[model samples]
Target: MFEIKDNHLAAGDLLAEALAKVPGIRHVKEVNDLSDIDKPTATPCLFYLYYGDQLTDAANAGANMQLKQTWLVVLAERKGSKQAGTNITATIRAIAGKMTGGAGPWQRVNTPIKPKYTNGHAFYPLAFTCQMRFKGALK
Candidate 1:
């Protein structure tokens, strides 16, 4: 018998666990949108936003299917502090060092974009990609 697993959720769980270990990470969670987060008790919060997923390959009859899922790791910090920029940069490097180029489910996609400032908050968006396989139907 074959079973289909919730790989997306699994990936998110793995991400949360890994991100929790990075120093200076105050909060980590999966959010539908970046605006969903209000004022956190701590700075340098990390949010996981599911971007999208696509079928990587067409599955023949009884063959497994492959999917590529993309996610965004947004690092948010309150602006105005002198160490704001340095803190963001250090946290970004820590996250990259811990999450990238490992046997993890996700891989860093590209360079993080410039910070976006809004309402005294600065957000740095980093992209990541993951591959998952769905088992074929049982005969």
Candidate 2:
């Protein structure tokens, strides 16, 4: 499939099962054991997610194009939760190499929707941002 589940929304059981399959265009997995923070009047909650990274640089960079592998960092956080919850993020280093002098060896990274807690599903009010630099661009 072109799109997969996000980390926050993935159920434990579903995550386990998906992991066993050969990743097609996308893959999803939830992570736990992360840090947590307690709210003033809310139950203490932990941060987690189902994450996947794919490389589409080959197609993006044609035979004449140069590929420069570089580390890329992705940060995801809840919009607002008393600002008490710890930010949960996943790092998929060197996802897409640089596109030489061109713009980039473009690619897309997707995170599953947060699960709902009531029906054993939880909502992850999260936002994501990315940072990347080409191989030789940095000093």
Candidate 3:
């Protein structure tokens, strides 16, 4: 059998699994638009995954092509209390450590720790750039 695997989607699945383990993260899902961001009903943290820098090539004897891409893990924490948002971001940092040096396949990059303020709310964002390699082909 033959198959075309999506490296970016695979990386995202791995990242989402890693984040679900963290207690402070309430909701996690792939995000395309920022205006409709909604917090998790069970928790205060909302996460969105965006993919960028996708590159692929098909230059081999077989019908398969090389694939690589980047994933952005954006975290938005609502500040219900004075220290609520702080606690959420701290958990995000720890998740980064696990993704970069732990058992995850993705490598973490340098991103700003500053929180963007809008509508009287605090939004913390973190992005992980993952370089993945795979062979993909369409039938």
lDDT of 1 at 3: 22
* Candidate 1 local lDDT, 4-49, one digit each (tens): 3754456666666767766777778789876775555567788887
Report the C-alpha displacement of residue 89, candidate 2, in angstroms. Answer: 16
The reply for model 2, stretches above 4 Å from the true place, is: 1-46, 58-111, 119-122, 125-139
Ranking by TM-score: 1, 3, 2
Task: Name the regions of candidate 3 deviating beyond 4 angstroms.
Answer: 1-8, 38-43, 54-68, 84-90, 97-103, 112-114, 137-139
- Tell me the lDDT of model 3 at 40: 40
Which one is best on lDDT? 1
Task: Please give the distance, in angstroms, between residue 115's alpha carbon in candidate 1 and its true position after superposition.
Answer: 3.7
lDDT of all predictions, in order shown?
A: 0.65, 0.28, 0.54
Assess every candidate by TM-score. Answer: 0.72, 0.23, 0.62
**Local accuracy of candidate 3 as per-residue lDDT tens digits, 1-139:** 1122543355556666777666666667766765555444444555656556444555555455444445555555444546565655665565554553223435465553456665546666666655444454545
Q: How many backbone clashes does every candidate have?
A: 0, 15, 0
lDDT of 3 at 1: 15
> What are the per-residue Cα lDDT tens digits for candidate 2 across 69-116?
222121222334442233222222222222212323323333334333
lDDT of 3 at 113: 47
TM-score of 1: 0.72
